[model samples]
Target: MASANATQSVYLDYAATTPTDPRVVEAMLPYFTEIYGNAHSGHRPGRRAEQAVEDARETVARILNCKPSEIVFTSGGTESVNLAIRGVTLSEKGDSAKHIVSSAIEHSAVLKTLEQMASTNGIEYTLLPVSQEAVVDPETLIPALQPNTALVSVMAANNEVGTIQPISALAAQAKARGVLMHTDAVQAAGQLPLDVQALGVDMLSLSAHKFYGPKGVGALYVRDGIRLTPSQTGGSHEEGQRAGTVNTPGVVGLAKALQLAYDEFDERTAHYRSLRDQLIDEVLRLVPNARLTGHSEQRLPGHASFLLDGLDGNTLIMHLDMKGLAASSASACKTGNPEPSSVLLAMGVPYETAFGSLRLTIGKDTTETDIEYSVSVLAQIVEKLYRLRQNYR
Candidate 1:
């Protein structure tokens, strides 16, 4: 039995990627062995693989509340985002307009691709700002819409701050103006309830790793009737939307992960919220001059981001790691660089505060004891670092 004083390490970076659940592992084992086959083959082995892929696609589609035909399997979240943004822009019918609207807080995958399109393809774009709560204002986008605007891409939830966006409202606004909408929902898929129809988005992106499935597999939901140009060319696969041999095991794992996510979403959310609240409460009680980041109530259930005054986030993270608690200074994707978090900058966070940020995301396996222990360990480290900084000053 687990206890409060257990020697096991605590991992609080679920936003980066979750460990594969045993159930998902079980679901994927067969695909890797007896059922292994090329989804494109016409033989018995091929037929088995093809059917498994189709079934996985259906499972993903059902979770998103979209048709199976709308789901296109890709390598991961980056590919899905690239395909959604570039595919729509490149496939636009006319030459009169070539512009897009996205936020500054988007992942590098989305931002870098848009930047490349702007430079090489002459695709002009606008990057909107976010509030202190890290939520983008839908009204800010109204004045930016041009007749040439091909699509508007925004994240459903911020990876660093965990602030949920007003996706439905934003998508509706874009739709009313005849512009397409796409959202990078990699961080929100399993943590929140998703309904593509209700969200009113033309395209959506999700990755398996973020939801406790295997890495290197993701899906894109393209609304019916939206024309998209294929980025990769090969024989007809994924209905010619995406091409290449499908990773049968990866797809099977993703479907199982998503199914488990949906089946236990309510209970998991509640459990994580309870632990998150306990963490925040204990941290505030034990640590001085630590402030929570992101929206107080509108954030993800398990996301607990904060800034510790006068302490370098990287140093703090290292200290915590030495103490056997794993956390991140910001999004795992943006770490190891000296620059402050772009998401925090977009929300108008000062450079100093942004540099001192830490993100601790709980998960299904996290317990109150884990939160308590983590808080205790972090408090000791922060105080030591703060004293050292003060002495140097």
Candidate 2:
């Protein structure tokens, strides 16, 4: 049950960003105060900071089933994706091949970088479309792969629709063709089990904050023996692949968060899954035109995206806000834009339906009562918005 003293309001935007866990905050406090020092400095303080960074790297590696040296810390998901794409593209092999394959529904971090490269003639890119179920067909990707295809990038899960991709299958295909495979696993990390080796991805990106850690820190996993050029040039940090001072405090918080999430994965998954199912059931029961988006069964544990006909998603968001329920129309990164969701568009949803989409993601902190209240509020807002649209028509 939500306490009457709960601060702010009900937060349903975990897909956008989650509050830093109290445990993570506690873990980070020492670094900010007593252990304040640059990881690059040459002193006891620096050594302590450097050790903390290494510890965090090991924790991240353990979670992903990769070597500690394979994890390159970056600013966040965006930087990780940029580094993975650009580094590979600038590599000797990538420069010669010049062709890349990805999904149309990838986060803008991937799409935008690929677009910029495409414009420069540095790479020829292909974006495979998704079906109405938000699943990309592996067969379609096979046809798009050229002999010179240097890399294939797909997301482990779609951030907007929560559609889990068949990454292992896709990676296997890329492997057979001798092309490297990368996956943006930012949204899939805590909600799903991630084993880079099992997934057969040559590279994977993850954000700490997405799983209850501090912001401004993330990691990229590079499979052993994969050669790539450094995207950022500076100090010999991150095995000389990435430069600049390590974010020691953020890394510590991330490692702690990752460890906690892994420890509680099964319990948290079950909890969020139950709440998610309940929310879906209530919305379908109460709302006449509510349609669930994404893979109905293969979706992320906590993601619940729906389209309410005749209701503007922005309007519904505002209404839900007024009722103290937080949600979004698409990925938080793409929110506040009037454009229809690229993910939805690629999934064959009409523009009108795309504009009517709402994404509500539950988290570890989300309670059963909270889901009940949010569902009740959403049903009411959708009905009200539909009637308003009808009247205007």
Candidate 3:
């Protein structure tokens, strides 16, 4: 029951979600209290609320370098992913375009949606394998595409291992084959460049909570000429793409948070990389048989995942929490599954090694002191566990 540092608690789970910025809260305040009119109503208050929604859409469009009309608001990353994949495949003209090509290490939102479609809608998909570094090779993706392939979906980065994928390269190949490309940018939204034109993707997904914005709000970027079947019907909201009353305050918060993140991107990433590298180096040096999981150089600045030999990942997480250091065994989406991470297994990690996985993602508030304390706590826990195992054996 000893505290990790005996001084303070450290949170290294930014990949799960981020603490919303106070500035974003400030921007969203008026919408909740004063401008609380329905966006679709034909009245003065409604007009004002509609303007605010449009303004927020414009802000998100500017960030993604897409037209405002191409952006559709959704509940969160899961909805965005579902919409992008299902909307396209279910369109009126989509009967002949049912096959999809994607990476094996995609987030479950993407994988599960595909599985659902395959079961009920006669959709077929190919999941390309990744390298040992957890990167999807563009060369491997080419053969996965078929004459009937409709879309190529891949994540901008690995949610669990933090490995950055070659999205541009993958999208380019899809484009050359006359196929549409989509990327789930939930994990990469605030930390990575999201210029849709540059990424060569026809559609991209974003979740506000990943970038210090409110939860329950996300956006899907579709190119101007792309056609999609409305996933949620009955209203003209989101240009008839989704049906529901617009979340004015949440959208305002999303825009403000994205603006602040990009404005401070250089400084924030430098801070994250500094602390992250220190933690990684110290943990590997101090703990025997510890191995870094993702691509060492191409991973997220704030992300560091690893495999600790001869330890259960969940057990390690419990010990870290007891010591006042918060972390994860894998993606928060798969928290209670009790199964080894599919991401690591897809990257060819042995099942036993995959069970020892640990993920520590630093955030804007992380510091050198926090990283130092986290490393000390993690090393001690691993050493103690190893000693106990030796004695038991």
Candidate 4:
């Protein structure tokens, strides 16, 4: 295959996950060999581990502008999302509260948890609709809010289309109504500027792997004074919220990666935007019937999703891969799921168009040459697919 041609390989799937920065790995090296210790233990090694965990917490807090005591370590984004939504709704006082208001475009973590809550706990929920651009207006939540509403869970940015949500407006409305607000910021963690206080959200989720840190480690920020029932009951780790052995290196890596991200924010954002805009413009010009998804300007710096009317997204992905360009049809979470992306459907895209959704997210390492090659190959693939379909017809 041409993909094996070495020089042609281009990776454009940063939205799914990122390559862990070597600097983060260097920071974490000692934890596994020299500094290995259970964070919960009281001895010297344990105390050392505990100090690392606390330092990581402070680093994360510095970026989010939250208190260190408010951060809860977890496995990853899914676990953090579940803990934030379920932990609150299932709390002693929260059990009586019944409704949740969120957008149809939320990550499946938020949507599925709400679904389970509605089914098992008899809690009521409403999914606000999105525009054709796959964005939810903040005002949509005003009418959905009810006296029984307990929490409002939305994403700071979408996993599929990379649409930025009006978190401040949504959180402000929820706060005025005395309802709690939570956001799945896994996709937005390092790509966009995130300050929980500025966003007016009581809770937020961040994953290390989403921002050039290791996988299997993430954190949830719950505003100080907010109470949540423990998801896993046992040890008093994570302020008695989650129970498990702390991943010492993972914690250190998360902080180190986030610190690097904060330091390189402006430079990275500009680079990503340049590649993203170049790709979008070239694809629209080169491929027939191509339509861009999500808000044109409000989208993430590295995101450029699309719907090509006459081609199948999966087929296009395979063709791109054979040419040594890596991309995805949608969220990585939906891998092996045959159905079209629910995110595109929620945006009112036609069934056929949803099947053709293509997501190509750039990263800090992406280059001008990679963008040019991807566009050249993509145009050829789309043309070839159309010809094959016509021959079949």
lDDT of 3 at 40: 93
Off by over 4 Å in 3: 1-7, 92-95
Q: Give me the overall lDDT of model 3.
A: 0.90
The estimated TM-scores of all candidates read 0.97, 0.96, 0.97, 0.97
Stretches off by above 4 angstroms in model 4 are 1-7, 92-95
Predictions in order: lDDT: 0.89, 0.87, 0.90, 0.89
Clashes of each: 0, 0, 1, 0
**What's the CA error at residue 29 for candidate 4, in Å?**
0.7
Score candidate 2 by TM-score against the native. Answer: 0.96
lDDT (Cα) of model 1 = 0.89
Q: Candidate 1: misplaced stretches above 4 Å?
A: 1-8
RMSD of 3: 1.7
lDDT of 4 by residue, 264-315 (tens): 9999999999999999998899878888999999899999999888577888
Question: Residue-wise lDDT of candidate 3 within 244-301, one digit each (tens)?
Answer: 9989999999999999989999999899899889888988897677899999999988
Report the Cα lDDT for candidate 4: 0.89
Residue 37 shift from truth in candidate 4, angstroms? 0.9
Q: RMSD to native for every prediction?
A: 1.9, 2.3, 1.7, 2.0
Query: 1 or 2, which is superior by lDDT?
Result: 1
